[model samples]
Target: MQDMIFDNNQVLAVGSEPFLSRFDLNGKILSRMPCAPQSAFSVSLHPSGVTAIGGYGGLVDVISQVRSHYCTFRCSRT
Candidate 1:
């Protein structure tokens, strides 16, 4: 795991294995999502609750404002 951030009553993580995982405030795993780069290493959240996932591959995924579920986002550069 490279980096993590908290947002929207949940913890978001990006790393090698789980790729992306969401955890509750109590530290229980909520759900696991697939990372585009597969080897994502960093993550951040926008004010709108959108998650920005960054990988060593110089790619970034901007997840939509996720509430109960992370529907989708567009991928771009580092």
Candidate 2:
């Protein structure tokens, strides 16, 4: 795993093929998302209740962290 963070009693891990995993405080994985062919190497949680996911070929996926309220945008470093 490249990195991980604990939020709201949930542990989020990122790395390798298991690009991301959501685990409870008890260490049981609740959900998971494998990396694509592009390969993700970095992730960040934003204070605006959003997550920024990045990968090869300058790919990025930004999603709202809020459950009830969320949004998406197609943005890149270019």
Cα lDDT of model 2 by residue, 1-78, tens digit:
666777788887666652557789999989775543145667777777676656665555565564322333334665
Query: Residue-wise lDDT of candidate 1 within 1-78, one digit each (tens)?
Result: 678887768788878863678889998998887766667878888887677787765667667775343443445556
What TM-score do all the candidates reach, one by one? 0.72, 0.64
- The Cα RMSD of model 1 versus the native structure comes to 3.9
Q: What TM-score does prediction 1 earn?
A: 0.72
54: Cα error in model 2, Å: 1.6
Off by over 4 Å in 1: 67-78
Q: Which RMSD values do the candidates have, in order?
A: 3.9, 3.8
Candidate 2, pairs of clashing residues: none
The numbered model that scores best in TM-score is 1
